[model samples]
Target: HNKRVAIDLTLPEHLPVLYADFKQLRQVLYNCFANSEEVMSDGGKITICAQELAGERLELRLTDTGPGVADDDLKLIFKKFFTTKKKGIGLGLPVCRQIVRAHNGSITLKNNPGGGASIILRLPLRPLITIGHGRRTNRAA
Candidate 1:
């Protein structure tokens, strides 16, 4: 992309996070951003957002101003070895789905209202909790 292409990111405050391989998560997010950039071709805007949800959950969203995906292909977008790209291995989305699922999270893709694609991820804010003495405690929600 070019400098004209805007990428916005937002994250929620006071959110708890589950134990996960951050490296893998970063790779997945990178792949998704790269895909969006490629689809834009000339250049477009990309936005990334995150929020804390009820029940110790987190939500992450990435949206792009590129051509949106076909309605029929939305379901198969995460299937392994399935791709519409001219020179793609077809494993990016699938791998991302697998990684998210492994962390008890979910990944979804949809078309933006204005025209573009959006990928949403839902994750847990705290995978495990330890209870015992000598540990700092916080009020329960």
Candidate 2:
């Protein structure tokens, strides 16, 4: 859309690395930013904050300044083929959720009390790596 979208990134210098599929994770972030851009056609701000949660997981909050999502649509946002945009096929969020789940993470969306919407993603810092006999182990990468 050629919109001027400003990104506000907040992350600690010593933040731990997450163990995940690089390509899939990048796609998730890209899809989120694309969604924000599509809603803010004129221009807007996207605030992204990343932090460690009790040394167990990483929490990433992506808040957009575009018009917030509707209450009724919130439940259906992650459902396949559910979209509010005229040109959107509604696979973005569903795919994002799927990718996140594949990494043993979770993705959620909620409207900001002030305005716009926020997408919260939580991923384990040490993703479980399965071994023989269904044994699992955590190794941060």
Candidate 3:
């Protein structure tokens, strides 16, 4: 199953990272990918991309070539414990939202351009600080 789902990852040249829990982030991403795979069932593709935006913000996008979400469900996808799947506990997306918001970031879900679903995560990147002998520099905007 892992071999069938194509995963693509892209990151910025230089990214400023805020105080984020890496373990939680990994869990969120893993859950997203797992959900996508479940929806695909027969097999499909998944792509993850990240880029640095202006004002020290980072944009992370996850797209899946599976059945897309309906318009009505879009607004409620992030609600705590709300899920459309019959077998799901529905905590995945809500947990993801919580983790992102905890870091002063935001997450949104939408239908992909052609077909399938897309999850977009926007995070405020922290600036870098450099210090030297009697000199200090702030890399955050």
On a 0 to 1 TM-score scale, where does candidate 1 land against the true structure?
0.84
lDDT of 1 at 23: 98
lDDT of 3 by residue, 4-90 (tens): 777777766766665457898788788888888888877788888888787567888999999999898898888887899989888
Evaluation by lDDT, superior candidate among 2 and 3: 2
| Residue 89 in candidate 3, Cα distance off native in Å | 1.6
Residue 84 shift from truth in candidate 1, angstroms: 0.7
The predictions' CA RMSDs to the true structure, in order, are: 5.3, 1.9, 6.0
Off by over 4 Å in 1: 1-4, 128-141
lDDT of 2 by residue, 34-117 (tens): 999889988999999999999998999999999999999998999999999999899999999999988888999999989999
Tens-digit per-residue lDDT, 1-141, candidate 1: 466678887766655655568898898898888889888878889999888777667788999999999988897999999998999979999999999887778999999899999999887765533468644333354
Q: Which candidate comes out best when scored by lDDT?
A: 2
RMSD of 2: 1.9
**Ranked by TM-score, top first:** 2, 1, 3
lDDT rank order: 2, 1, 3
Off by over 4 Å in 3: 12-18, 127-141
What residue runs in model 2 are displaced by over 4 Å at the alpha carbon? Answer: 1-3, 132-141
* Candidate lDDT (C-alpha), each: 0.83, 0.92, 0.80
Q: What would you estimate as the lDDT of candidate 2?
A: 0.92
Residue 33's lDDT within candidate 3 is 84
